[model samples]
Target: MTHELGHAVHEYVSKKYGELGREKSCAQAETASIFAEQLVFAALLKAETDSKHRFILLAKHIEEMIAKTYRQIAFYRFEDMAHIERTNGEVSAQRLQEMFKSVMDNYLGPSVDTTGVEFICAGIHHFFEYDYYVYSYCFSCCVVNSLYEVYKSGTVANFAEKCMDMLTDSGVENYCSALAKFGIDATSPTFWQDGMRLFEQELSELETLEADIMKRTYINLEKKATH
Candidate 1:
C-alpha cells in the first residue's frame, strides 16, 4: 500500500516538476516499498506465536517479490542496453519478444509453470507507458533493503526524520543522489552485492526455520511448492 502511494507521489512530482522532480519521486516511491515491507514483516513476526513459521512465510513471499522484481527489471535493463547499442529506433516486436523470452526463462527459474501462456512479452503494463520502469522496482528494492538494515539496526541516527525529509524533497534529485544522503553509493557494485546479501540473510533464516520448525506451522509446503 505504501509502495503504491510512493508511486503516486512519484507520478505527481514528475508531471508537475519535470526531470528532477521525477527522479525525487522515484526515489521516494522506492523507499516506500522497501521500508513498508520490512515494517510489516517485522510486525507480523512479532504477532505470531509461531515466530519461526511466520518468518518463513514472510521470507518466502519476500523472496518471490524480490526475485520477480529482479527478473522483470533485468529484462528492462537488457532492453535499455540494447536500445543504447542500436543505431536507430526501429526494433521489431518479434525481436523484443524473443529477447524477453530468454530473460523470463533465465530469471523465472523452472519451478513455476509457464505452460501455454506467452506471458514473456505480452501485456506488460510498462510496455506502453514506462520504457524501463520495471528496473525501478529492482533499484528501489536494493535501496530499501539497505535502508531497512540501518533503520532496523537502531543505528540510523535520526533516520526517521531524515527519511521524512527525503520524501518531502522527492523532486529535488535522482534516486542515487537521494540514497547518497544515507551514505549509500548506488553506482557501486558493492551496492548491488549488499542488496543480494539480504537475500542470503533471508534464506539463512528460512533454512534455520525449515531445519527446526516449518512443519509445525505450514501444512502444505510439498504440495503447494510455490508457497
Candidate 2:
C-alpha cells in the first residue's frame, strides 16, 4: 500500500504522469517492506496462545528491529557527516571501524555485547553504494508511525483501501499530499515522535514481563531453599 499507493499517488500527482519516479517510489517501497514485517510479527503475537512466550517474542522482535533500524540509520548519517568532513579525502579502514563502533555503542547501550559484531562494519553495502541513503530506514519508520497513528485513530475511513490504491499507483507523488489525507505532515517532528512512542511502549511491555518473571523466579527459589 505504502509503496504503490502512497508513493505512486504522490509521484503521479506531483509529476502529472509519473513515468519513472525513483526516490519516492524507492522510499515508499522500503517503508512498506518494514511495515509488512511489523504486521507479520504482530499477527504472530496475536495468534500465539502461550502467554509466557508471547511477550518474549514481542520483546525480541522489538529490540532486534529497533536496534537494526536505528543503528543502521545512525551509521549512514555518521558516514555522511564523516565524508563531508573529509571532503574528497579517502576513508580508511580504521576510520570506518571507529565510526561504526561509536554508533554501535550508542544504539546497543549497555545491554548487548558489541565485540561479536565488530566485523559487521566491513559488510555494510550502503556505506559504499549509497551516500547517506541508509538514513531512509529512519525516515521509513517515521512515515509508518504517522500512518499507523491514522490507522489507530479511525479518522481516515477506507485508509487501507487508499493504501492499496497508493501501492498500485507507485510513482513520484508528493508524500505531503499522501500523508495529508491522514492529517499528517512528514516535515514535522510529531510525525516521527508517534513512531518512537510506539517503540518505547513495546520496550515497556517487555520490561514489565521481565520483572514479573524475575519476581516469580525469586519466590520459587526461596521456597525451594526453605524446603
Candidate 3:
C-alpha cells in the first residue's frame, strides 16, 4: 500500500513537474515508498502492546534496515571495486569473490561469518544487468531517512505540501536541490549518517526489548518449575 502511494505520488508529481530522468525518478519513487513503510511501521509499533508482536516488528525492521542500507551499500562498494579491478586486468572469479567478501564483511560486521560466502555475491544479478544500480538503494534509503527526520522534528510547517512540491518538481531539480527545500543537503558527508543513526537507534531499542522479553520468560519458567 505504501509502495503504491509512492508510485501514485510520483505520477502526480511527474504530471505537474514533468517526468524525471529514469534514475532520479526511481530514486524519488523509492524514497516515497521507503518513507511510507517507515511511517506505517512507526504507527504499528506505537499501537502494539504485545511484547511478542513488538519484538517481531522490531526484528523485521532491523532486518530491512540491514538489507536496504548496509547490504546495498556493500553491494555498491563491491561493484565499484570489481569494475576498477577489471580495468587493471582480467579479474578472476576468485579475486572477485574476495572483493565481494571484503566489502560484505565491512558492512555485516564481526558477528556475520562471511567466510566462504562467495555464493551470495553471485545472487546479485544487478552487476550483470546494469551498472552501479545498487547505489540507488543506498541513496533512496538515506534520502527518505533524512526526510523522515525533518517530518519528525516539525521544523517545516506544511511538510506534506513541501513533499508534494518535491515530488512534482520531478527531474527539473536534482535530488540535492529537491531535498534542499526540506533543509537536507544530500551531498554532505554527514547526510548518510542521519539515516544510519535511525537504524542504530532502532537496533538499540530492539536489544533492550529483547532483554526484557528474555527476563520475563525466565521468570515465568522459574515460577512454573517452583510450583
Candidate 4:
C-alpha cells in the first residue's frame, strides 16, 4: 500500500506531467515506490523493541534488495542477449534454455550449480513483456538507497523538504537533474556505491544483533545453571 501510495502521490504532486501523461520512467517510478517503502520500514524499525524481530526485518529487506538489484540486473542481461540472438534466427527452446543457463551461471558464479535451471527463463513474465528493461529495477534500487543515505546523513539541510521538491519536479527534470537537488551526482560511480552501502549498513547491524542475541542466550543459561 505504501509503495502504491508513493506512485499515486508522485502522480498527484508532479504538476509538470499534466493530465495526459502522469508517470515516470521505469527507474524513476521504482525510486518513488521504494523510497515510500523505506519510510515505512524506518517507522517499523523505530517502534520494534525485539532484537530478533529487528534482525528478521533487516534480513527480509536486504533479501528483497538483492532480488531487486542483482537478480533484476541478471534478468536484464539475459533479455538483452536473447533479443540480440533473436535477430540471427528463431531461438529454439533448447537454445534459449542454454542461453538462460549461461547467463545465470555468469551472474551466480561457481557458488551454485545451475545444472537444469533453464526453465527459469520461460517462467519470468518480464522476459515476454519487454525487450530489455529489467535493469531499471537495479538502477532505481541504487538511486533510492543513495537518497535514503542522504536523509540519514544529517549533512543536508531540510533534506525531506528538498526531496519532496525533487519528486514534484521529477515530471520535468531527468534523473540526473532531479537527484542534483540533493547534490547527488548520478554520473559518479560513487553514487551507486553509496546506495549499496545501505545494504552493507543493514547487514552490519544484523550481525551485531546476532552476537548480542547469542550472548544473552548464554548468559540466561548460566543464570539457570546457578539457580
**What total of clashing residue pairs does each candidate reach?**
1, 13, 0, 0
Evaluate residue 65 in candidate 3 and report its C-alpha lDDT on the 0 to 100 scale: 75
True-vs-predicted CA distance for residue 72, candidate 3, Å:
1.5
Model 3, C-alpha of 61: deviation from truth (Å) = 0.8
Model 1 ranges off by over 4 Å: 6-27, 81-93, 109-114, 174-177, 214-227
Clashing residue pairs found in predicted model 3 = none
When summed lDDT is taken over every stretch of 10 residues in candidate 4, the lowest stretch is: 15-24
Expressed as tens digits, the lDDT of each residue in 1-227 for candidate 2 is 43344334444443443455434444666566666656666778779866469777977777665754777677876686678757878877777677777777777688987884646877878777777667777777767756766777788889878775555444545767777777887788777777677678777878888887789889999999999
- Model 3 whole-model lDDT (C-alpha atoms): 0.82
Off by over 4 Å in 2: 1-25, 109-118, 222-227
* Candidate 1 residue pairs in clash (backbone atoms < 3 Å): 24-170
Q: Which 10 consecutive residues of model 2 have the lowest summed lDDT?
A: 2-11
User: Which whole-number lDDT from 0 to 100 does residue 222 have in model 1?
Assistant: 68
Instruction: Write the candidate numbers in order of decreasing lDDT.
Output: 4, 3, 2, 1
Better of 1 and 4 by TM-score: 4
Better of 1 and 4 by lDDT: 4
TM-scores of the models, in the given order?
Answer: 0.74, 0.79, 0.85, 0.87
- Per-residue lDDT tens digits of candidate 1, residues 129-180? 7676667777777777778776777766889777766765666656677778
Q: Show model 4 residue runs off by greater than 4 Å.
A: 20-23, 109-116, 219-227
